[model samples]
Target: MMGSERSRMLYERAHGLMPGGVSSPVRASEPFPLFIKGGKGATLFDVDGNRYSDYCLAYGPLILGHAHPRVVEALRKQAGEGTLYGAPTELEVEMASLISSLYPSMPMMRFVSSGTEATMHALRLARGFTGRSKIIKIEGAFHGAHDSVLVKAGSGAATHGTPDSLGVPEEVARNTLLAPYNDLDAVERLMREQGGQIAALIVEPVLGNIGPVLPREGYLQGLRELTSRHDLLLIFDEVITGFRLAMGGAQEYYGVRPDITVLGKIAGGGLPIGIFGASEEIMSWVSPLGKVYQAGTFNGNPMSMTAGLETLRELREKGHEGLFHNGERMRKGLQNVLDDLGLGYKVQGIGPMYQLFLGREEVWDRAGAMRSDATLFKRLYQGLLHEGVYIPPSQFETCFLSTAHSQADIDRALGSYEKVLRGLRP
Candidate 1:
């Protein structure tokens, strides 16, 4: 199928109820979303039989790539047993243990259905433990669509945050403090201003929502030290970087630990799963162990556990051979090719995730990231999509690479990118 009429018809029907004709606002792109049939390895097929070497990888959950045979087989087997039992299973313990072992910050964990739930509960547990109402979150850092995190730093990243959403109550957003990513001084200022009121500071160890902006040198260690000096808890939102950064996560990468850690995306293999864990002392503040109440009927569902467990097992077997360093090699090769083309661009990434920012501006933070040439980036994205290399549609979002992607796939994308940049230039 080649942009067949059926995809258009489907979008038309979807528009009647689904706002923007998509479930998530971010997924709605220029020329509308593409409807896909099925995927195998790293490739996806659309309704019109168009095929692409997908780098989006469902926004980083499919590190093993789309419909991985091992994960698919496990899902099928679990399907035969049952879907959801609503009871504890040995698989839950196994997966949680695996994650805990990888990220030492997570000594104990609770499984939930989505990253949103993982972060939402983390906020609650922090507040309950500290009896403090305020929380510090990095600006432009997305921790799900939760109200507390939906705030922007006032007058840019230097000031306290203001509500970013319409319905998020002022009282709720007031408890949320914001700072720019990669600026530890801003974090220190917030700590001095609201340390007593603040219960915890939550951040994406590596910002993924706005490409893969990494921490500036000494940024993570500074935060760790500052939080320790003050009486506040540090939280690492590792949902996107958890399993992909190494089988361990970003906290492991930086060698800086947090009081609580959030896990999602890659942890699920490809299914929907979220987890938050910490030392026994901090986790004890959660329900049953303490007054903080966090519960989900679908928590620790067997399917997510099975998916997470199997994915970890597979990665363990591979011994980090194909999962991450492969992505690094691909990124370096693509960057070198872009440099040869004399294209003004930058590759902001870590491990298996990356985003191509078409600009000369040093993207140290979100403001810098916004300086990219949107028109050129859009053209490049569409050009690649047409040439059978699928990436995230927006310049603001990061694209992911999976083990399913090959050197040939990277070569193809680099060649297409070079050609497209030249075309868009003149």
Candidate 2:
């Protein structure tokens, strides 16, 4: 009834070719996924020619929003020169210098192709630097898809009901410890039991995968102290929060400095990029200087460098005040709608990231997040799609706001939300 004839046909053809008719598990939906033709600013044009105000933002990369003029022009210009060289370019150095200035904790860094690669290398470097085999990860904080951090992963894993993938070896899973997010006691217990055996504790300062669950007060500082006491490296996986939260990311926002930082998503300005960085001493443990041994043919590729540089330049010049203000406005508006409807659903986020956890009042950790009504969320998602507002398909995934989103877009989305919610009231 919602007019998806073209999308339905495409999905039928695709289902036989690609698994679940999607490259990513999270993109798979009930009837069919909307095939996006193109995007500009905060809107997506589907294959069926329906336009929707996009809030998923390609899973948190397009902070400046889709196809910003500056980023597009920069990429076009860079493409004429050449795409990849298999050799280092000046773009790499410039991008690295710019990022180091913003993320002061990372004086030195290496570029990778994706967040998974960055986190994989970071975990290896941590182990090499500390000469320990174990690492700790928050229960639902997704570091990457690597064997080391896949246990209890969030995002696509949580959405599809597979927290632990079947392919990861049991031996690999054993060394990776799990602690509930926002609970330092769980981390302390793990450390107390086997602190010496652990090389690092990697966390998403704001758990962006399962939910944009904000950190409790002083929770990050407590982690820093605890990690220091146990002599384990503190790695901040800021792939989702990097530039979206602030220019300096969660580390700067929370005033907690991590030993290593893994940044992606917005860092590449919607391009495929991942970066792992730290102090010179810690980074020295990586390849060409020490024996950590991480290499990629496409590391610091020029196209991603140009896009990231331009994106960061724009953010630096414009500043993030408007983004923050818009974020608060969106969250508050959503809360007000829920209040008016008398729905117990929770609105949770900080900075530019937020998620509406249907049927839950408070969600601080993965357990709480999972307790939300997924069935009701699916109904709301479909209703929103029909109303020309596109949010992430899964309730477990976070929704984002961008500089491209305007006051009108926010208000329109809120109105659509209220209408759909009222209709669903029983």
Deviation from native of the Cα of residue 18 in model 2, angstroms: 1.0
How far does residue 211 in candidate 2 sit from its true spot (Å)?
A: 1.7
Candidate 1 stretches with Cα past 4 Å from truth are: 154-160
- In order, candidate lDDTs are 0.83, 0.90
Per-candidate TM-score against the hidden true structure: 0.96, 0.96
Candidate 1 residue lDDT tens string, 1-426:
266477778888888979988998877877768888989988999887899888888887987778788888898999899988887888887887777778888889989999999999999999888999988898778889888988865674245357787898877887787788888888899899778888998989888887888888999899899888888999999998887777788887888899999999878888888899888998998888888898888888878888878888887776656656656776787788778878768887877777788779668788887778877777888888877888888887888877777877777877777676667772
lDDT of 2 by residue, 359-414 (tens): 55688888898888888888899999999999998889999988999989999999
CA RMSD, predictions in order: 1.6, 2.9
How displaced is residue 274 in candidate 1, in Å?
Answer: 0.7
**Model 1 TM-score, all chains together:** 0.96
